[model samples]
Target chain A: MQGREILFIVLSLVACFAGLGVVLAKHPIKSALSLVVNMFSIAFLYFTLEANMLGITQIMVYVGAIMVLFLFVVMLLNIGSDRSGMKILDLKLVPAILIALLMFSLISFQVLYPLFGMQYPVADEGFGSPEAIGKSLFSQYVLPFEVASVLLLVGIVGAILLARRKA
Target chain B: MLEEFISNLHPVLAIFVRIICFSGIAIMFVPIQVWWERRLLGWMQDRVGPNRVGPFGLLQPVADAIKLFLKEDHVPSGVDKFIYYLAPILAFLPAFALGGTMPWAPAEGLYGLLTPVADINIGVLYVLAISSLGSYGVVLAGYAGNNKYSLLGGLRASAQLISYELAMTVSLAAIILVTGSLRMSEVVSYQTGPLWGIFPYIQNWNLLTPTGLVAGVIFFICAIAETNRAPFDLPEAESELIGGYHTEYSSFKFGLFFLSEYAARFVFSGVFATIFLGGYNMLPVRWDILAVDFPGWSEWFYFMHSANYWLSPVAFIAKCFLGFTVFVWVRATLPRLRYDQLMSIGWKSLLPAAVANFIVVAVWIMVTNLYGMIAGYASLVVSAIILLVLYLNIKAVGFNESTSTKRRIKMAKFNLKENEESN
Candidate 1:
């Protein structure tokens, strides 16, 4: 394999482990931190894909902003580790594991299906540029983008309403 | 020799050399900055500061570093050992890494041999992302310290950072709109154009333009808050939190926190210099434009232009130092803001001003493209007036009466409690 492919493989491995760390970590803060690592690794994966804009946005939004708020809340609440030591074979674990496996398999199949024999298509010039992304969003996917933004605004308003104290 | 040495190396090796060289230079400035800030602050406060360590205390940071190195490292009990160890390194890395996207010189000729290690397209966003990462160091440090003061400091740092990030981003958005490129180099080059797109004799640094002035002011304020400098430094208010996030740290670890703060200050200054202060140009005059306009003095103008261009890295460094001086100046001038005041300034004032500037710049650009310059200016004036009127109305209706009523009720309740106590 080329160096790029090898590098991608290494990054993806790191990302997978970090994802596991996020779910498996006992302490809430540790879990949040693992999720940050996972996000950063995924951002690197995006960088490797040559989606520079997407990679930076992922870091800026998820790791930089959202995970920070997660950390803040976790820290503020002073939560501790779960020491219940629930058995792996618990009834709740069986269905959770089964559903997780099913979803993983489905996602892998969909992803790997495209790369079975065909080579990846070459990216167009400036394909991952801000201008290109902006143009495409405005011209082609404008409706979805606008709708998503409106949905976010609604979510924000709803959150404010829920959090507001009554007189 | 430097150029030949750089060019002769393998591409990957060359990049490494550049990264090391640039980072070393930036890191070296930290001690100098420390010394300068001390002397400057001392001067401002009418006292001699650190003058006994070295000549004008030039070697004070060196002495400080030595002391920190020799001092025994201490780990307080009940601390999160791993995170406690990790925090300082975390703080230091992002601050140093902030230099990665900074263009010390234009990517041309002699000066371009070794600087701006990354030079990626999304330079501004990269800065924002990395800067946001910086808060992790402070936040994590606070958490790991296992102290209530540390936790409060960490919480405050996180909230402050997130709030200011919005204002900083929106303020920079105006510049991005004006430049139409996310690349740092492009932003610099755009500034090299004719002043105000009218005067051919002067360079159009962002700070000189109307919308740019507003954005620059807001961005600078946010940068100050982002670095936790005085006035906005509620997170680490020593009087309240006893060194805040680093209260539990001592020895080299504490030194690391100190180094990172100064380093971040230096680099953030460099960024402000690049964005608003016209990158590396010696002065705001366009020698090239003069060279074209007046052929009789063309040789002299060309000479001046070349001097400005080739010595750009030096100019960039000087600008960064100057910006650092301004940072120190600001610290000396302003008092530490109260926590509520800090939050309100970040959210209510800076954010709104930045957003308004962004909208005005966007409108200006759109109008300029559609009609002409005059029409664009007209639209700018009209839109600004409308925004001002709307802002006043919103303030009058939403804030003035309700706040007054709330204050009155609160005062009456306080009085009633006082009377009850007397009885």
Candidate 2:
């Protein structure tokens, strides 16, 4: 395999392990930190895909801002490691296992089916430039972009309303 | 032979050499900054600074480093061992990496060999992203120490960083709009243009323009807060939090924190210098323009212009040092702000002002693009007048409402007294 492919494989493995760490870690802070690792590895994956702008945005928005908030809340609450009294054979485990299997099968099918005759197109030189992204965002995808912005605005207003005092 | 060796070096080795040089110079500045701050602070407060050590205490930091290394590296009982070990590294790394995108000199010719380790397209945002990561170190340090004061310091740091980052990014967004690019080199080159696109004899430093001046001031304040310097140094407020996040840290870990803090200050000062103070140009004067405008002194002007071009690294370092001095001056001049005051400054004052400046820049750019320069100026004046009038009207209404409410409260009190008497 080429060096780039090797690098990609390594990054993907790291990302997968970090994702597992996020789920399996007992402490909430550990899980949050694992999620940060997962996010950073995914950003590197984006870099490998040559989507530089998207990769940067992923790091800046998710790992930098959102995960920081997750850590902030976790640290502020001072939560301890999970030590619940529930037994291993709880009824809830069955449904959770079923759902997990369902998700795994669905994702695997989509991945396996795509491997048969997939062909990827080469991206142009300016494919991931900020100017290119801006142009497409404002011109071609303006409607969806505006809708997403409005949704964010609604989210902000809702948050403020929920946090406001009764008076 | 040396030139040939450098030019023909492998790409990977070249990058390694460049990074080593960049980091070596940056780390070297920390000791000097430490000495400068102590001497300056002492002078300001009327006392002798570190004069007993080697030659005006120039070697004090080296002595301190040795002392810290020799001290016992103690860990408090009941602390999270993993994160406690990780915290100082996290704090130190991001601060060093923040300097990655800062251009020391023009990215051409011989001077381009060692500065700006990474000249990425998203330079400004990269800075923001890295600086945001710095708070994690403080927050994690606070949490891992398992001390009340450390936890409080961590909480404060996270909140403070989040609040100030908004204003910082917004103010920088105004500058981005003006420069029309996010690359650090582009931002610096934009400043090297004619002052306000009119004055040809002077370089267009961002501090000289109206909107740029406001944005620069806001960015400077936010940089101070981001670095956790005084008066915004709440995270490690010694009197209050007892060294804050590093309270339980000792020996080398604490020394790491100290090194990171000074390095961050030096880097942030360099960033400020690059963004606002005409990165590496010796003066705000365009010597080339002088050469063109004056034929009699053209030979002397040409010589000076070439000197300015070649000696840019010195100029850049000088600017960074000047900016560092200002940081110290402000630290000495201002008192630690109360928590509420700090929050209010970030949210109410800096954020709003930055947003207003952003809008002004946007409007100016749009108007200038559509109409000509004269029309842009006219639109600016008209908009300013309209905004002023709107502000006055709002103030008047608020004043009337407040007075009426007060009078009503007085009347209600009087009525209650009369009712009691009748009963």
Candidate 1's TM-score? 0.94
Task: Please write out the lDDT profile of model 1 over residues B1-423, one tens digit for every residue.
Answer: 878878899888988987887778878888999899999999999999998886888899899899988888988999878889999998999988887878888788655767778788899999999999999999999999999999999999999999999999999999999998899989998999998889989999999999999999999999899888888888788999998999999999999999899889889988998999999888999998899999999999999999998888889999999989999999999999888898889889899999999999999999999999989989999999999998899889878889999999999999999999999
- Residue-by-residue lDDT tens digits, candidate 2, B1-423: 554676688866877877877778889888899999999999998898998889998898788889988999999999988889989998999888898888887777665766678788879888888888888789889999999999999989988998999999999999999998888999998998899788898999999988889899999999999999999999999999998999999899999899999888888888988889999889998888899999999999999888888898899889889988999999999999999999999987799778888887888888999998878777766766665576577669989999999999999999999999999
- Compute the lDDT for candidate 1: 0.90
Report the CAPRI category for model 1: high
Q: Model 1: runs farther than 4 Å from truth?
A: A83-89, A98-114, A165-167, B402-423
Candidate 2: give the TM-score of chain A. Answer: 0.84
Can you give the lDDT of residue B331 in candidate 1?
Answer: 94
**A1-167 per-residue lDDT for model 1 (tens digits):** 98789989998898899888887887888888889988998999998888999999999999999999999988987878876754666798889988999998998799867668977788987868788888999999999999999999999899789967886
On the 0 to 100 scale, the lDDT of residue B151 in model 2 is: 92
